[model samples]
Target: MADATPYEDSTTPSPTVLSQDITLNWKTKATVRLYRPAVIPPKKKLPLIIYLHGGDFVLYSASTVIYHNFCNDIAAAFPAIVISVEYRLAPENRLPAAYFDGLNAVLWAQNQSLGIGGQDPWLEYADFTKTYLLGSSAGANIAYHVALQLLDYDLRPVKIKGLLMNQAFFGGLTRTQSEKNLIEDAYVPLYVNDVLWSLALPTYMNRDHEYCNPISGGSYMGRVKGLPKVYIKGDYGDPLVDRSILLAQYLQSCKVPVYYRFNQGGYHGIELQNTSAAQQLYNDMTWFVNDVYQNLNSQDLSHHHASY
Candidate 1:
């Protein structure tokens, strides 16, 4: 059952930024907040970043103050149009509900790209060909599932060039060393983490379910091989750090293009709370996005040469 009381901070005032909220599905109240740069170049189409906010899948919304601030910074830094998805949370909607909302967000983007959806001024300057999925913690989990869902169909005019996962939220039935040794901090306490998982995961599934633990082999392992280029950043002190390492190793074993970075002396979701760390991660993400675009161009050039 869903928690009747909503989080107090969920509706906190957001920093002054150029953003607008739109409803993707009126029935389910699924919506997304679109953020744009303070200044837009004439007739310039920038890369699109579809962001998912982290809240252990049971708390927070796209309008949450921390998430809104983070998206604003990202939009200004990367000069990219960001669409922060407001998916239905768990307990109320459950596991696959969030996943479906994510897919709907992507489909909405596709429609906007084609000019079939309702008018959105920001979409006019959105470069769908370079769209990227950006998420933090539980949001990253949603991004991963959305990427997998897209594999079954063609999303023309809207290409998912890469995935940027920061402090991804994943769990297993067995505890890792970090989980056992690390003391619960302000960001995420061990007991709270367990409770959140119990509330978010499917009623019939455990921590090892593929939705919660991507590395837990089932159908997930088979689908991982063809995923888009991925960039993962994790904190050494985070309990989920080992999960990131394991995921990186698995992607490598499957020959998937992946880049993983571990930040020492940090904790889960530190980037949002710390200014310097947030700037550095933003810089890293900017570089990664540029590199992905460069690689895509090179591939195009090679195909052109082959055709000649």
Candidate 2:
């Protein structure tokens, strides 16, 4: 599996968005690519989007062209400040390693938002209080884990207002209906999914472990409380579809604000898969972001309910 993205040079502005990369951790050389509208309104701060690209968990980096193009679209469409992170991958780092990198990335954003560390010029246009996290496929799985883990931190001024998961990659020892039904899926086959888990999960852990299957954990509820509003997108034709629905149901059951859409005839990361699918994905994302922003700006979202 691989997770990554980057298209234009740091110095180049693609018609709408301008992007640049910054190293987050010097020792590990972990980096994050930042994107914002080519032209910004003076004194208008935009929402911050921390995104993770997917490749199951074993492949890719922020330089992956497909993911990079997607980020460009997101930054321009939302007219937001987007940060695509580069993390330690599996087969070498494994499970919690990526999760930890995710936490570090969030914290780094917190510091930037608070001006604890020196701030970047682009971040000056970011409304740190309206932060969001987005991830696709295995990156979504990482996003989910990161959101939960963040509940344990104190990132004031860096509120996570929403989470967006696109065809989140999750599995278990027991086959879900969608997993069995889509075993021979064209986009991501069952065999390849199994191999990804084998290489990405902890050496001694099986598919039933908490990282692979969140519902399998008895105390997951305690860990998942107070998560930001969640927007989950599942592709009916993808092998991970069941897990996507299952996650939404679980989070809703926990009373976490949830909004989900399960579209027919699509595969994992469909947004990055093709032009049409990408348009729909962004449209869905736009709707969700707009709703969340409107609610946050005008009223309290603490009472937000599940909307499928």
Candidate 3:
């Protein structure tokens, strides 16, 4: 089930500075990019964020324009270690391929912290207790699934700050009115979604499977209880907007704290551009992080559940 070296065409080169880049020879050779703050040893262990870039699970790459920009922006904003995973795309490598790559990258990131100076950087500079998981579009799907996997493996971080799923993609066979509306929309037509599913799936598979669409599989509702808080955002006009809403509802029903935001303008990829949409998203994410930190540290760990 694991073919870490699936991406034979894409290779990540070594970092020129303190940061390094390498492929985890697992499911596919995932192009893992590590960004270290342009600073020497600091007094504190920095938080680490593992960001998964989205490209419809088939179209984009870690080097893509938007994904690249987003990585830089987050690294600058948080001034922490940021690791971006370039998982295998669909059609060439299907469904669970990306999921496994995501998990492996996280595991790698967890280990990398220890070697920042001589050991793996994932464990070195990273305060694993403050680890954060984030992604956009299809990458969000990977993040969500991996978050669940992290919980399952009992590898939960001491402090899973939050999950930032921007324009998340979560759905299945049953489409919503918003999804139906976008069936013919120029941005993301139904045919394109069908192709995405085909590429994302291994050989021939069900799109509603837990690995493909967690919401449809009823897996999301069951495991959202103790999961870390989630921040979801999307545009009202987007096809998968309903999926975000439905997922947020499920999370809320499970008593999970969810920060949901939806706007009326912008297309699926518009948020990647440095426009009003992107600024709004960036602002919300910053606020969400601050809120989580304040809320988490405000109370003693012994009485954490009481505050929630």
TM-score of each: 0.88, 0.90, 0.81
lDDT of 2: 0.81
lDDT of 1 by residue, 126-164 (tens): 999999999999999999889988888689989999888
How does model 1 score by TM-score?
0.88
For each candidate, the alpha-carbon lDDT, in order, equals 0.80, 0.81, 0.69
Most TM-score-accurate candidate? 2
- The clash number for model 3 is 27
Task: State the weakest 10-residue window (summed lDDT) of model 3.
Answer: 299-308
lDDT of 2 by residue, 140-205 (tens): 999988998888889998999899998898888999888888789888899998999999999989
Tens-digit lDDT string for candidate 3 (144-167): 888887777644444567888888
- As for TM-score, the candidate ahead, 1 or 3, is 1
Best by lDDT: 2
lDDT over C-alpha atoms for residue 262 of model 1: 73
Residue pairs clashing in model 1 are: none
The order by descending TM-score is 2, 1, 3
Report the Cα lDDT for candidate 3: 0.69
